[model samples]
Target: RRRTRLERSWRDCQRLWKWVSKKWLEKHRDVHNLKTIWFLRHPFKIRSGGEHKCFFCAYATKKWEENIGNRPPRTEKWTRCDYCPGRLVDSKFHCINAQYHYFNHPDLFCKEIERLNILRLRQETVGRSQGRPHA
Candidate 1:
């Protein structure tokens, strides 16, 4: 049987993810945690004439939406944004902003991630001190 376009696109996304993961691992050799590398999908909508545009950046495209009206809504898995490298998370594309900041202002992104990690560590410490089970 022939593969559907959606299936092909999914395969491409998996390949892209693998490449990104490999690059990230090379850069952060000591950090094996994959959670820090977020893949997010930007917010988009299909208009009356099959047009689509990202809500956040107003990036417009019609290339990816072929036969979109016949396809079921994507809810269970991450979908790549047509405009950016981010994948969809919870139907939102907040990772696009993160990736943009990561490339354009590396220090800012690193600082923010560090701050968040510190806060998380503090919370964990507090929880452990209170005898709460690790979540």
Candidate 2:
């Protein structure tokens, strides 16, 4: 029984280590590479209180031609409107994960955007040179 308990504890430690390692990698990867904003939650936007509006503002009343705010959210955190009058503290703004990336690491975000833009320009230039229709 002691041996079994020890094995279980060891497994738990391994699981925790794996989780930590994965989180570390994800955080580091975000700053190191340029990635397209995902459209799965496309037009992602977070209001000043934590409300996710469309991809840009906190004031959106709909999401992608559908009603979103009327339904009860499954999570407790989502139940309350983040932007409801004075919910946010000074020095913080409601922002989505992608927005957080820009807010917390402007330099990294700028670098990624610059890199992606340069790549895109190169692709466009190549296409133009090859007589391909401008995309």
Candidate 3:
């Protein structure tokens, strides 16, 4: 007997998700609960002051400007990271694990996407078994 591609992929995704989740929990020990996790294929864009900006980047820029109102212009642009206050490169996929907490790791993002797909498939299967069409 051989395992199907989807089975193998799901197993890999589970392993990655476990590792990532553990690391996140260890680093954020104060956070007792994670309400929702969002894996966005691209950087989230929001309209701010009539201009579209990367959500994380915009937040970072706003904070920077506030702190340097009376000082000379910053030589470099402000950034934000999942674990720290830094810039988020828009070229990579973004993950919002909690409010204002963003992750831009490509590998972890891909695994999360796969995990979501697998969960959806499982839900549909269970629904069909109970004679209910998946909505």
Clashes of each: 5, 3, 4
Encode model 1's per-residue lDDT on 50-128: one tens digit a residue: 2212221222123334434544577422132432222221223343365525444334434443444455457668999
Which stretches of model 1 miss by more than 4 angstroms?
1-94, 98-100
Ranking under lDDT, best-scoring first? Answer: 3, 1, 2
Measured over all alpha carbons after superposition, the RMSD of each candidate to the real structure, in angstroms, is 14.6, 21.9, 16.7
Q: Write the residue-wise lDDT of candidate 3 on 1-135 in tens digits.
A: 685433443444344345445656457332212112212322333333113123333444454555554444544333333211211223232456532232434335445455555665776699899999644
Q: Worst ten-residue run, lDDT, model 2?
A: 83-92
Cα lDDT tens digits for candidate 2, 52-71 = 21222222222212334555
CA lDDT, candidate 2, residue 41: 24
lDDT of 1 at 115: 49
lDDT of prediction 2: 0.35
Full-model lDDT for every candidate = 0.38, 0.35, 0.41
Compare candidates 1 and 3 on TM-score and give the better one: 1
Model 3 ranges with Cα > 4 A deviation: 28-118, 123-135
TM-score of each: 0.30, 0.29, 0.29
